[model samples]
Target: MTTATPHHLPGTDLALEQLPKVSLHDHLDGGLRPATIVELAADAGVELPTTDADELGAWFAEKSNSGSLVEYLKTFDITTAVMQTREGLERVAREFVEDLAADGVIWGEIRWAPEQHLARGLSLDETVEAVQEGLEQGVDAARNAGHRIRVGQLVSAMRHADRGLEIAELALRHRDAGVVGFDIAGAEAGFPPSRMRDAFELLAANFFPATIHAGEADGLDSIRGALTDGRALRLGHGVRLAEDIEVSTEGDGQVARLGRLAEWVKDRGIALETSPSSNLQTGAIAQWGTTLADHPLDLLYQLGFRVTVNTDNRLMSGTTLSRELALVADEFAYDLDDLLVFQLNAAEAAFLPVEDREALADAIIEGFEKAR
Candidate 1:
């Protein structure tokens, strides 16, 4: 069903939620509805810091803003705790799609580690099927409500854990069902993509696409590992790729010189999923500055990098994709065309087949044209 489109660009009547968008880096666990978490926790008998939906939401925001990765990750413990059983996974996945549809997302890739959901004794394959079932239900519901939406699962392997190869195979096994791609997430600093070379190698051999979490909590070296070892087609929250570029002030202008690594990424048109609010929360953009305006998204976009806006964690960051877009637009002084470009970038970077990607791009253009 359509949710209220409350967010709009400054000094304009354009509602950001009315624009068709594509979400690539959104975490399934990170986007759970606060009320859903409350009910699920009760059924699962999990202890939460707060049972109130509003209070729980605020708690997530507070924990995520603690400026420590450990603290930020601790928030997931609560969300994942209730997602152990088939019912929990199904409900969460279904609601995730409905929320995306409400936010005007015509296409979305919901990424989560199935490994974490096995605490209740469900097989890895079972978890994926449960989520896929929910996703289909949500899509049907959205269509019945006159909102067209499509969603795909990106099965993620936890980096700190040693189940990369198994998770990668699981993704491949379900590719024909609903899985679109594979990913490695959790604890980015110490556990590089090289640690899971076998898994990446398997995916690459199978001609599967992967998007690794790099250039977020880590730096250029981690990004290198994601590209070389993980063979990632996309970089999740690759905000720190900006670090490899040297910007200098020239006569009334600025010039950015790309390093070898940055040149490789740019030349390849590898998509950078830049989530503005979450970047500030996790200190991903700490070196640049402590505010949204200081984020390198504008610089990367202006320099022709395939940069896409995302709400890394809607609940934790207290944002929607629409709200994130409005915030960046306000900070970067972007107009309607600029906003549409970001959506188009995400559509192109989607892990769909070439024909599907082109169709999504065409739909985005038509929607934006109508809005204009």
Candidate 2:
């Protein structure tokens, strides 16, 4: 699944796709290849907007750019519909890892809601097992292909659903097997992380880590809830956290003031999994501006906030981690050093143990140095 050519920093030969990267937030159902979807749709008896793979990919991109999270999410119904069976899940999950390897991801956490795939008679546990089986196969395939790619499942509970605690327990059950963490996704405006207080409490009691979706479709309050209620170790698209930072011009340069909430996130080093393209498509960065130059990723990075680049939905956004970094780099005029910092930030924010996180960071540095 590797691309014929790698994505590079604009006006530079530095191959962004060849650099080791750590993806902290990526959705499984949202990353399917369009051709695979057309094939699976027939087997799963699902209808599609088009049987043509190229057109199907274009349809997803257009639907996702609606500037509304709810509207953008409608595209997932088609992807999730085709992923109901064991074979469908396995193929999607396997291709997911291979795609990450193709984009030079050293490690990634693929998040998906298991409850969404149960319409075809698959139980919660059964869905997790099926995906994990596929992940193992994907990892093995990547290794055989000479890509040092590793991945873990961050089982997500749909925020609009009432099965948070149930899904949390499911993640814990597979903690040692293949699952690495827990997440709550889907609609974000009304359903704050506080709605899943019991699930967070359960995870906290067992000392398991969580990364909650916040500051994307919602605002400061949602980010607050993610920290206080969800006990999130990382934030899924916490771009709107920038709303709390006030920048004012001083004698010469501008000085930024961080509100209490912003300070806590920065001081504690809670990672913001900011996906530039997806942020724009979801209107997550609308308050700032309509283009990449307006993205708070650069602001967050300059302010020393622990920010990690991601492709929230590869197929929907028509991107890879490499393309994300390259796009942002082009907008912000970032250099290789800046790129390495993002990768190191993500490695530290990964759900792996402290020692393993250190090892991952080392690998990223080693890879970047070689590429240089």
Candidate 3:
């Protein structure tokens, strides 16, 4: 029905968008379509730098590529401004799932802070319900369009805000209603998860899963706090965990020695929700280098850390899960099996029940096999 050439995997004819994928770290507000933003801006009484869809999209990409996490985050102000109303949140959420489905993402976790969407006097409870309704609509829309996709919300609490526990309880309240996990996002350097010990403790007691954003803007200490205090089952952009790994020239070949923290993380199989493009844009991987080839993703994967690729912010990074995988494969020379492993790692790391995770993995394997 369409003549657009499919994006094939490098060195193979396999269509990249046809490959099954699991996205564990996509943000809701960060993935809004530029055209949708333009439409919503008018209704929300929000002005934009440019109303042209393509230019607005380019604006986000260029502004976010500033190589500073703080600077990169400034772009969110434009996105979240239009997402204050129920209609805006619902439309964004619905489109988010549809877009992921189009990108061959079989499953995804959409993270966004409810506290940030209250500017229009909508209650937190109302916002969560609105999002859930939209997500359900998205799943149906994707199904109708002949794409199979499942999505869940990972309600994020702004780390800089003092509403951690309140946000945690909000997630817990909606745990049975489409919400899958909890997370702490925004300005990760000064705001360690330890500061939200009460929130972590509450979620832990309730047997809820948390994936904290750590090791991105900070160092190993931040990751340590995530594990010890935040009890994070997964690290959001845990790229800095590579800092603890000491790699050296051992004559003919390289050797890597893991620090105690690194050892703990790898041994425990704590998932690293690493986003390559977002990491570079936010300077999360600056310590290693500026280029994608300099990313320690390969090193971490070689060391057997549970590494999972993600599109942290689709609009800002101008990426999808499929695009992220292609970038990684281009940099690392990964084959089909390697890409499958990344998807499986994310499947295991997903905050779903054992049976559900297993089912998800089975679906992924089947999809890859079909590709073969």
Candidate 4:
């Protein structure tokens, strides 16, 4: 069993936190610090199960460990409830970046659905601006703390809602500001990417990139819809794509075969945002097992898929990118070289420009080389 006490992998210390990293699939709402959540919830008059930060953090960990997506999603109510107004959103975004910087993230793209934050009378544009303001503040704070961190917003439209086009335009409006990309999140089963065709069309016409929450709560057809209808450049929790891969045992190792869809994702180098803890929490990898060892990340990595490690929700999953990599390393027995590949995958798949992507890659390579 995994211990509750957090410890670094053998010979790695906490050095992984010092290794420059790029995060492509982190969620702003999913990553509030526990103490900050307590303060924000109190100010926003949001009721939480516990006021103690440690207990609150443990509550999130316990709830998400239930191995059901429904149970896992219930924890978000508190986080998003306090995030309804401008202050709540700004503080959370700002602290999110601070926490990422402390975790050694050099670059991160935070995704959140603005439509969900409109409940407190904030317009879609207002919500985006508030988040941008917080992101800038976080960047300044990181710089002051001597940790250089760059963050971008990925505006998400709740697929269950019908405001995709409006959210898409909001993303476009802030493209030059703090917004970097677009995404479709929430209820990935019935509300397929096809349901947001108008929004994807607008984003595509505007030459904006998108990453859809596919292959998580749904199957291969959902992934297909994400690629075809949403025109997703990356796959969120695309772990289920392993369902399309057939593994046959050989003498010592295994031989694998990929379906056409999996082949396309592999050949195109579409990034797979594999979050170990959150994937298990959401039952996204239930077909495999209830353990990290059952995660198909190793299979996908071996097959040359662009697999990047992430913490879908830091609070909910009770994880950091360092912790996620440690868990995967433990399960897969991966060394420093393997971890560097994951960082490089995320750096390459980042929504930054070509030159910036190269720079991020260089940073990751340098960090890994030092660790080795």
Which has the greatest TM-score?
Answer: 2
Candidate number with greatest lDDT: 2
Which candidate would rank higher by lDDT, 1 or 4?
1
By TM-score, how accurate is candidate 1? 0.98
TM-score, prediction 4: 0.96
List model 4 lDDT by residue over 216-244, tens digit each: 99999999999999999999999999999
Instruction: Tell me the RMSD of model 3 versus the true structure.
Output: 1.4
Q: Report the lDDT of model 2 for residue 296.
A: 90
Candidates in order, TM-scores: namely: 0.98, 0.99, 0.98, 0.96
The C-alpha stretches of model 4 lying farther than 4 A from their native spots are 1-7, 250-253
lDDT of 2 by residue, 51-105 (tens): 9999999999999999999999999999999999898999999999999998899
Candidate 2 residue pairs that clash: none
Please give the distance, in angstroms, between residue 319's alpha carbon in candidate 1 and its true position after superposition.
1.1
Tens-digit lDDT track of model 3 for 298-323:
99998899999999999999887888
* Displacement of the residue 157 alpha carbon in candidate 1, Å: 0.5
Whole-structure CA lDDT of model 3: 0.93
lDDT of 1 at 242: 91
Count of backbone clashes, every candidate in sequence: 0, 0, 0, 0
